[model samples]
Target chain A: MIRFDNISKRYPEGRDALQGVSFHLPAGAMAFLTGHSGAGKSTLLKLIALLERATRGQLFLDGENLTRTGKRKVPLVRRKIGMIFQNYRLLFDRTVFDNVALPLVIAGHRHQDIARRVRAALDKVGLLDKERALPITLSGGEQQRVGIARAVVNKPPLLLADEPTGNLDPELSRDIMRLFEEFNRVGVTVLIASHDLDLIARMGHPQLRLHQGRLLNPEVLAPPQ
Target chain B: MRPPAALRVYFLRHVQVALNSLGRLYRAPLASLMTAAVIGIALALPSGLYILTDNLQRLGSQWDGGANLSLFLRHDVSIEQAEALREKLAQWPEIERLRLITPQEALAEFRQLSGFGDTLDILDENPLPAVLALKPAAEATRPEAAAALKQRLQALPQVELAQLDLQWVKRFNALVDIVQRAIWILSALLALAVLLITGNTIRLEIQNRREEIEITKLIGATGAFIRRPFLYSGLWYGFGGALLAALLLALAFVQLNAPVRELAGLYESSFRLHLLEPGQWLLLLLCGALLGLVGAWIAVSRHLATIEPG
Candidate 1:
């Protein structure tokens, strides 16, 4: 449900972050965006999220032209998508329950709906027992789960994860990937940006590779074993 | 599906967040009280000055009616001529009230009341001149108008000189003018101080919560949404400060009332300190809210933009 056609981005200081990149993903599709650091993977995700405008070329999310979208409408587009970060980005001052309930709160859900949905999302992340615990009291993996729960609480159509398991151990990272897979199986499109080629190989998903701001053909990468 | 309800709910949620912050302040009652007291004193300085100015103006207007000219007739002028002049002066619109005092009558009253009857018996001719005590109209009570009227009265052949009793009133008016100007300048300076205090407080709060804001932005929170709670916090500060100021001013007026009344009683007069009217209270509350909102807006707009999902 996202299309980036010949999109290019260049910083004001003469750095080309993305160069004539194009991609399309159908509804309910899942893919991994693989690249090394400074390989323009974040730039591609930001363009799709409308956090940054492309310097040239057109981009669309669910057939809505994002390249020409006004700044005021960017929030509308963002609300329909969820984002998970490697840092978890949980508010340490709040309980895990409030942290996961945030997206629904931002979407103006009723109090009953917020309570129900937050509980369900926390349940999905296996953090239902730690609902009242503050982020500072939770372990890193637990905090990341809270972030994942928050991302999916609003039931957004698309989920974008920027190195969601970057700080976790191999076992925890695999478990997190399984959580993402479960959501994808339930019809939520998921795009994850990562440098973990081994994890990609284990998952056997379609891979979109970026090198020096250019998209490499997915077919050239050996199929995940 | 309706947007207005959604927007209102959004705003209310932020308001809830703001209330929670205020709850934190309330939890530390003694510190909050001390801080509020300082803000109250800061706010009360200007409000007290404004009340003083208002009362001073009221007292001045009461005595504005006291301005008058005493027109003394020449010793050589006959009683009939003095009577004719008095009648002529009565026709002038500027003269609100007048009374004639013939020389013979003036001397008789002076001798009886002044305890100088033995000294007055040695005089062959009456020393006192016939006088017309003249009160001016309200519009003609200013120093310039009184001086002009004095000059006009002196030009009359029967009149020796017209003494305008405007010295005390002129001095009081000058003092009131200065006090009014000082009130304006002080209010402006104090308002600036209020803005700075609120702005700095909000800035510190933003710094403390920088992580929260960055996290919010990363999770798709809009700038407006992120800025909402801080704005409410500022508003709470302003509202509290203004309420404290109003209370302080009211207490001051209450404390000063008895002494002011006793002093007025010494002059056989009735005077009271004017309490803040309903409209003034509304203005104070509104001022507080606006100060809070503006200060928060400045702090949030400057710092929140620098934070991103890096």
Candidate 2:
């Protein structure tokens, strides 16, 4: 449920990061955002996340105008959205259980609720046995699973992943894609940004491609299997 | 779905997190003790100066009451003339207390007080003049009033010379003023030193924990959320430091109390050192907490902005 209407972003050094980009994805829909390096994929995601303001034009999330939202309200808006990073940004100093519990903690969940939800999310990632292990002790694939578990722990309506499997092997990448599909099947809107065309093609999801800071084409919905 | 009492839950959670950070401090007792000790020493310098000033003020107030002026009659004046002059001077509204000493009584007092009673027995005639000791009202104890009164007494026909005993009081007041100004300057310098010490500590902590902070931000943790624990840690440092400083000051006062009491006894007076009042303790605690909070805030604000999530 995000809409970017002719949004453009220009850095102070006169470099255009995003130029006249526009797109819309409906509620509970899953799509893959693809572009080459410096093609403005991150800029588009940043605009939607309200981490960066657009230089021109309006952007909306779930029908609320993000372009007009003040700085103080950004945190509240972000609380409703979950983000997973390519680096698997687990807190190395904390246990796997604590890493997954972070989103719920930020959402101010009760202790009991947080424990229950975190355990369930960890179970979903098949890491229930390693709950007490630190991220540094985990394999790369396991760390990514921790990131995924954290993203879904809050049960947010929207999930954004920036190159979720960019650092994973082919087998692990497929497994992570399956994890995203499972969440999408349960009605979470998911948008993943990546340069992995083959992976997107294999997943057979709708594609929104970006080229030189502009949306290159309308949504190319996958044909029926 | 909105929870019925989410804000209370959130506040409790924040407190829990703060306590958890405090627990970490407790886990490393030696490091915690050293940090707190440094903070205590920084706090103690000013606090000790304040106590000293307070005690000096009390001593000054006690001595202020004993200030008096002595007027000696001329050698040719008779006892009856000196008595009449004393009675007339006692009528002045500024005079609080007065005593007339005849030449014979003055000579006797000098012999007893100066420890020359045996030697004075051999003298044929008394050399001391009739003396009038006058204690002025509190408002009239200023240097100007005492000088004017001395001039008036000296002009009397029955008087040889009038001497004001206010010189000691003036010197004591001057010393007290210098001590007070020194205390103010010392407190100001020590406060600045405390701020710098706390700031440097927080800066080092930031450098050490840079990776953890970057990771937290990358996971969408708000700056406030990431900064909360560090703030609490700073608060703990301040609180612990102030408590130690207070204890150290109290111990010092305890150590000095006996000697001070003995010295006062030598002068046939009872003097007791004053401990810190409740208000002073509260002020110390407040100062510590504020310093910790400010130091941590400055450190976090300066370094947190430079970290970017890749």
Clashing pairs in 1: none
Top candidate (lDDT): 1
Q: Can you write out model 1's per-residue Cα lDDT over A8-118, one digit (the tens) per residue?
A: 999888899999887787779889998889999888888888777899998889889998888777777887788988888888878999999888776678888899999
Across A94-155, the per-residue lDDT of candidate 2 in tens digits comes to 89999899877766679999999999999999999999999999989999999989888988
lDDT of model number 1:
0.84
Could you tell me the lDDT of residue A193 within candidate 2?
Answer: 96
Candidate 2 residue lDDT tens string, B30-135: 9888888888888988898889988976776566345688888788988888778878987898788799888888887788799989888898988888888888
Candidate 2 Cα outliers beyond 4 Å, as residue runs = A219-225, B1-7, B27-32, B62-66, B69-164, B214-223, B254-269, B272-274, B308-310
Which pairs of residues collide in model 2? none
TM-score for each model: 0.82, 0.80
DockQ of each: 0.46, 0.39
lDDT of 1 by residue, B124-208 (tens): 9998999998888767777788788888998998889888877876887788879889888988888787777777878887898
